[model samples]
Target: MKKVILRTVFISLLIFSCKRKQVDIPIFSYSILNDSVKNFKLNVNEKEPIIHYEYFHQKDTIKRLFFKYNSDKDLLISNLDTFYFNKKTYNSKSLQFKFYQKKEINSHKRFLVFNKNYGLLANLAYGSDYLFLKDSISEMDKKLLFKALFYDLNKIETD
Candidate 1:
């Protein structure tokens, strides 16, 4: 009876003490992304709308972002990038976001994505772009978000 209790306690401690491995999310960069993926093609096929375009050592998905917004009236094949810490503002608490602006030019197509995890609850594009940090991020943030997204679609790499 004493031996059984000791063994059970030992096993419980071992199980509870072990930590599970966590998947690492890599920082967003143009180099880490695939230059030639079509959002629509992959979005319709996946069980979930989100797709993992970024890989770590080709081993596993490092990070994922909201990849598809399927509104016909609004921007089609549109995606959102992750919020980044605002370095210019010198505020570590402040975050800045980038949006993927998709376009068709001369019948050629390209997909450019760079984002961190954005919650659907706040995605108003799908009637879910809620105010993530309602107190910290205000209506002004939306204006800034649009301005950044409105920039030129893609600046091809000459190198």
Candidate 2:
């Protein structure tokens, strides 16, 4: 009887240890505006977040995106939107642009998984307050959230 009880306790402990732990990561608020010029912003829940202008354009079904100045940082322009290149610079500053395209195999599946994991409400009634915990967000979502909002831009191809 004692051995049986010990086995039960061990199994319980193992199961508890394997459970997923919730974590609170900074949730980024994303937005786009159109007023004579198109603008985009992604900011954490903070004041005075750094602002940047990123571009995305699709040509012959091949999509590409670029930052005003090529930066390999935590934040990048989302490739989900359409951007038209303007021959103008920001603040009179010239930009050096490098571009990339998406290369994920099951992007649609990944996106659905992301929404499910994150509990993202697409059609929630406005002004609904909820406490959301960020945990186990998939690699695809993380890249989309931080790197680019599109898909695998890491895979390279050449003619």
Candidate 3:
């Protein structure tokens, strides 16, 4: 009986120890705006919020701007340009410009995921916002917007 009880306790402890650990999942939320220029905004609770922009154009060309907020509510903006050299070609050219205020070091991994998945809302809303902003922007701005947003999304770090 003593030996059996010892074996049972050992087995229980082993099973408990071998159980998998819980991983932390981030909660993400966002908003979209459109009028004259298009825009997208995303916020991850306890983390910074991201904003993107696009302009109106008759041609297929696109211009874009991406930005995020620091703890102090300062803006870090990245401008991007996406252009197609040929209609049939899958490849495209992109240029990137980055601007931001310095802050404490923190991983932006979750932000990347949120951006990639939810960033489309910005594009959809840009036309309406363009009307509201009452500004005509260049095609280059659209391209830059996409590049900055996607690049930031891809840079998310995972430990």
lDDT of 2 by residue, 55-138 (tens): 222122232222221223323234353222222111102323222222343433112101212222111112321111223344
Of 1 and 3, the candidate ranking higher by TM-score: 1
Q: Which 10 consecutive positions of candidate 2 have the poorest summed lDDT?
A: 109-118
Residue by residue across 60-157, what tens digits does model 1's lDDT show?
Answer: 34433433433222222333333322211111134433333334333432323233332121222322122222123334554454334323223343
Question: Candidate 3 lDDT (Cα, whole model)?
Answer: 0.31
Ranking by TM-score: 2, 1, 3
lDDT (Cα, tens digit) per residue for candidate 3, span 28-110: 11222322333322222222232333222323235323433232433333343222111111112332222222233243211
Would you list the rank order by lDDT, best first? 3, 1, 2
Compared with the true structure, model 1 gives a TM-score of 0.25
> C-alpha displacement of 142 in model 2, angstroms?
15
Clashes of each: 10, 0, 29
Give the TM-score of each candidate: 0.25, 0.27, 0.21
RMSD of each: 15.6, 18.0, 18.2
